[model samples]
Target: MAATPEGYMSGFGNDFETEALPGALPVGQNSPQRCAYGLYAEQLSGSPFTAPRGLNERSWLYRLRPSVRHTGRFDKVDLPHWKSAPCIVEHDRPIGQYRWSPVPIPDASLTFVAGVRTMTTAGDVNTQTGMSTHLYFVTASMFDDYFYNADGELLIAPQQGALAFVTEFGRIGIAPGEICVIPRGVKFRVELVAGAARGYMCENYGAKFTLPNRGPIGANCLANARDFKTPVAAFEDREATSRMTVKWCGKFYACEIGHSPLDVVAWHGNYAPYKYDLRAFSPIGAILFDHPDPSIFSVLTAPSGEEGTANVDFVIFPERWQVAEHSFRPPWYHMNIMSEFMGLIYGQYDAKPQGFTPGAMSLHNCMLPHGPDAQAFARASQARLEPEKLTKTLAFMFETRFPQRLTDYAATLETLQEDYADCWAGLEKRFNGKP
Candidate 1:
């Protein structure tokens, strides 16, 4: 089938229906006694059967073969770099603010799945209560290899290059400044469209990432629901010796298969992969004076079932106006209960104007004091109070309620800025009792 322009269907969480072949999908029923085109009917569920109707997520698929035909005897495999949670590797690294330069892409051949290097993990994967942050450096595409994670869904943020995700639902192409999410337990393979690709990935082990409730800001701004694009029904019917890998409970298992698993001719569901452009995000901040909390810039939030707390909040700081009168433009120095892992996509972040470059990252654990560096603070404190625009900057945070544990690979990376704390050294004590 030919690729569609924009190659996607719009809207988020809307039940969608698509069929590559005419009269392929069964009408009036999810499955029929006899299928059209001699295809098998299968159901994929993203939530429990007893879930509330509003939260229920399931999909019906008409494919060349049922998913049961996509596997054989399972054999354990090793993907050393892809670590999961409850993964606290003992190291000499201290518990404090840390920063790292852009990690160089590996020279050896690495596919999307094989290239995943876990930088930090929070909560526990076994209990399905936390998330893992990873950096992927892909140099090769999966030709006959396919993979799926039964543990959790993946939220991918591309910082460099583009990727074509060939999945059971359809094909989705994503590039830098864009994000794609693959639902848990969906079989897919990644093809590098830019020769090589580098990106950040968040594996959510709790609830799925959904649009945050816009109470006073209303529904029109901050990631409109219509902007999220889910791919239309498309599939490949190729017969060849193939391998399928499964990541379950932090362990990897491989199985042999004779054909591609992405053979779905038709599908109708709310549970599907989707992509969004980060530039489309509508930001709202303080209009008069004083800077609002970064929560106002949240693009999506995965709640931890507790009020005012998030399992993980995917927040971004994009290009916007700085017009707060008599205020410190950059973020202020304060300790937060929520742990933060920040990354730069392009341009400079106002908070750390010096060392934080694109593809670089910093971590501040729970209750850790962090804010504008010495230079950023001095400039913002003394600069004129006229209207200013922060152009060409895109920074984001993976803010979580759980403290993140550093992976051994992350702690040992040559890019780790050991002197990250020195940024606060220049803060002169201006305290005086006589006010």
Candidate 2:
């Protein structure tokens, strides 16, 4: 809410307090009987009230008008391409590894919500137990329209251009190598900062994403708390006709509103949107021998009800040094219980060095063996083990415990590489009885 737009408060999940106006935020109290500056006090809860202290999340907002006044009678709207979980569409393609070239940014205008093309989904949205992977091709910004998702929180990784998210909390600007997460039920509008924007989005329907535990690796070396930025208080106070859309229960509903919903003048709480730059992540790898499991590269993990297993893990392969000695390097062949939907943000992914371009995507479902392409395998096996830096490359994955099912739109997209499996075709059998 500060006059300095896009300013952020540092730290992850800290009870941040900010105000656009002096004394707008109450002192020593969350809600006062009489609010200051004639603003209304509202509570935004991200978790159940009785949830554990560490897990509970809630925010108190001082706004020009209460949120209830921001909407009218709702009507159903159609966003055909934005599919949700439990959306198993019939397809002819068999189960195996799949990859796609960049989904082209269309000439026609498309906003963030309008351009969402769901590629894969897992678990059930109704039960809030799964996630969805989507590619967004944004050509235009939302002017007088705003949207909020009731089904799940959104994690966005931009690959092509830049975006400015004006939310109820504040503004977060992200570019090709960064990500932002908008919490469930947070009203926000996406504005294109560059000509056109392309990105990968993950809709997490389970628990909110949290920094993964380091365990034996000790207290630091991954995503430090200070690097996860939450925007300061900022809001819009315009009076004009606007439309608000809600994605609830995997369906779309729209309502007419008299004014913009981004009117929070001040707020104090941990339940808000935040962003992270992939460049800041401190990656740890095997130094003496073989590489660690990909889980070692996890940036954030949304845990399931079970212990240890994750509902969704946001992992990244960023610019780093590869120095393992006598190791196969570049990810070794293996099958995972979790499904992986990976995308490149900027540079070449070391695994599929040939076709996995920036803005491209690859999907490997549960128990499906996948690893470096034939060329990558041959090159890594022959190259000398030294401290080599993988510069300017940023790739990421939305790995989930549930199997990812392809949407009809994705299954038949022309960009989907039909011969994706051929990347491994050149692998020669190297088994030797003498060895």
Candidate 3:
């Protein structure tokens, strides 16, 4: 981990090195390879609902991965000089069923999930759950504050616009469709430049995310480590009164802290701020047989407890081939320890059809029972199982270990689609009474 400049320590905090995946994909292999199958096809057309591609187009063909984004103009905004309200609040009024309502962070201790919802319908609400996945989103402003999740890492996904992330180590900008991972306690903030922004924020309160044991898939499959990029050491020696937002025992609070939060004079561990573009993801598949499980596409993961358990897993189902003959082509229904909080950047999520849209979110708590709706299941069942190409759409998840509890703000937002809860209403029970 890189160290923060001299005096920035107390506010910025220290970051540890994340345990590298047991086997990381070699760097600079088949980089920027392009095909008509997944994200590439969508990028080629310049669509907002498309995924971000690696620095090059031919990302998949290369043996190693390429840099996800080319460095751009990164600005350092002096937060102390700007005027703002005291960064703290606790609300009691109920809003609606939308996640991004402006509610005061509750004063009473509570584990509430906070963040912006891009898209959703009733049956599927993407609840941020990685670790104790507590998410936050900023619109048209810079998040010049500090946050802590007790004992978990931070998973940040930006759905729209760009974030000029000014940590102690220089500045890195994450545009749409990009994910930034800040390890536990590493204080940072977001400065939005494009437009209104929203996405997932998971505050993992368990073991950090590590690559799942490939087991039968050998040590190599999805998410090669070298593909992950950590910013070079960048330090800031400025003095200012920045805000700090801490989530402790389920409640959000603010303190009148006066210092930059990206302070880690010097440290070494496996945790750091790394970004990944979904387009660079090399999808492993059961080409001639059937669609493999989503685990096969996990680019980064913060595991929870033991093996097969995850506090949060950042998984994507980008544009890819559908060549499974004589098999159901969409996601199958199953319950898992990790609750799933999903969102779409652009295009359709293969698992659902009509109601799901770009900027929509859905949450399927652990064991709550979820999958393709009845309409999707029926259509996919009768459709031809040919090698159909699914392109343009890019959807992802912030899967977590805890069952997410909706904040009053999210339970009552004006934009909250009231009829969405009925998405699964048409599902049928076909069990015969013969047992």
Candidate 4:
């Protein structure tokens, strides 16, 4: 297979070293009294100083100036559309299973930051234990504007065009079907690569996302570590006016600067941005006679401290086979405690085949009764018992332990599918009570 054009260092959670300039990184010791090339040494810690060695995450950066000098005084700015958790906005709408068509790209200019529209929020941003789902419609790039979220890490899944993420560590290019994670407090700017870009984002305010344990599967399949790519060291040595933005506690703040913040000439650590291709995901499903739980399809999970429970799980429904004999292959009907917010990147999801279009989203909050719609249930029940391939389809779920509250913007959207319940209306009372 051809390497990604942007290039990447393989492996997950491995201490990687990259330098834009040769001999720029110091040997052995992380910090020397006087750094080479008059660079400033700074440590960026993703975890606490006393965190266990296995969970510790920190990186050493050799940059033009310390990060403290990159910002001035901060002034609070309002982003009405982008909201955070514990946000139970009062609305007339009832809480039930709901779906919406793809939000249209704005006709006016909207940068990545300005384009973020939060649909639902779970947990609390201040407590840092939940997540939020957002849709970004980027028509303009952030030329001199840089941003970092102090409250959470971002998992971006593009559905329209490509994006070039120029970060303090390096640059990562992502398109539809590929996802990139920017760790908390990593300054970066989004640049549009394939014109305007539209995508879904999961802002996790809990533990960082990690590959799930393979258990009895023995780690040979599902999301392999080698497929997760962290970018090579890249930086800019330019002098120009720039603005740095900070998103903390659900509020936005900006500071003016004289140079780009992405000035790191070299960096080494496991705490950095990385991207993964969904197509590279090796999916495991029912090969015999029963449908497994969706947890079996999880690509990454952010734990909630409790064992087996996730603060959030990023689960994908990628192309796979269906060979369960005398079984209803589509997901069975049930109410779940975990709130599920699902999105389709492309093709038809077997569960809700008709109304769930690409770029569309649905929310099935805690204990909400939902499953395969009438059309899907009918088809799966009558299909022949043979190996079938579900191709060209990709869907994902951002399921959380906490209940998600819809934002006012989401509830008021014109594209909201008011008739979403109709998909299940045809599921007749077929229980004959005669086994």
Q: Is candidate 3 or candidate 4 better by lDDT?
A: 4
Q: lDDT tens string, model 4, 1-435? A: 111235589989999998877888999799998888899999999999999999999999999989998888998988788888879889988889999998889887989999999999999999999999999999999998889999999999999999999888888999989999999999999989978889999999999999998999995899999999999887777678999899999889998999888889889998999999999999888877888999889999999889989999999999999888978899999998899999999998988879889999999999989999899998888888899899999999999999999999999999999999999899889989899
lDDT by residue (tens digit), candidate 1, 1-435: 432333689998999999988999999998999989999999999999999998999999999999999988999999999988889899999899999999989899999999999999999888888899999999999998999999899999989999999989888899989999999999999998967899899999988889999988875888899999999888888889999999999999999899899999999989999999999999888889999999999998888879879999999999999899999989989898898989999999988988999999999999989999989988998999999999999999998999999999999999999989999899998789888
**Alpha-carbon RMSD, each predicted model:** 1.3, 1.2, 15.1, 2.5
Candidate 2: which pairs clash? 1-20, 1-233, 1-234
Off by over 4 Å in 4: 1-5
Report RMSD for candidate 1. Answer: 1.3
Q: Enumerate residue pairs that collide in model 1.
A: none
lDDT of 3 at 123: 15
- Candidate 2 has its poorest 10 consecutive residues by lDDT at 1-10
Ranking of all predicted structures according to lDDT, beginning with the best and ending with the worst: 2, 1, 4, 3
Candidate 1 regions exceeding 4 Å error are 1-6, 432-435
Clashing pairs in 4: none
State model 3's lDDT.
Answer: 0.50
Q: Is candidate 2 or candidate 3 better by lDDT?
A: 2
Say what the RMSD of model 4 is.
2.5
Q: How many Å off is the CA of 201 in candidate 2?
A: 0.2
CA lDDT, every model vs. true structure? 0.92, 0.92, 0.50, 0.91
Lowest-lDDT window of 10 residues in candidate 1? 1-10
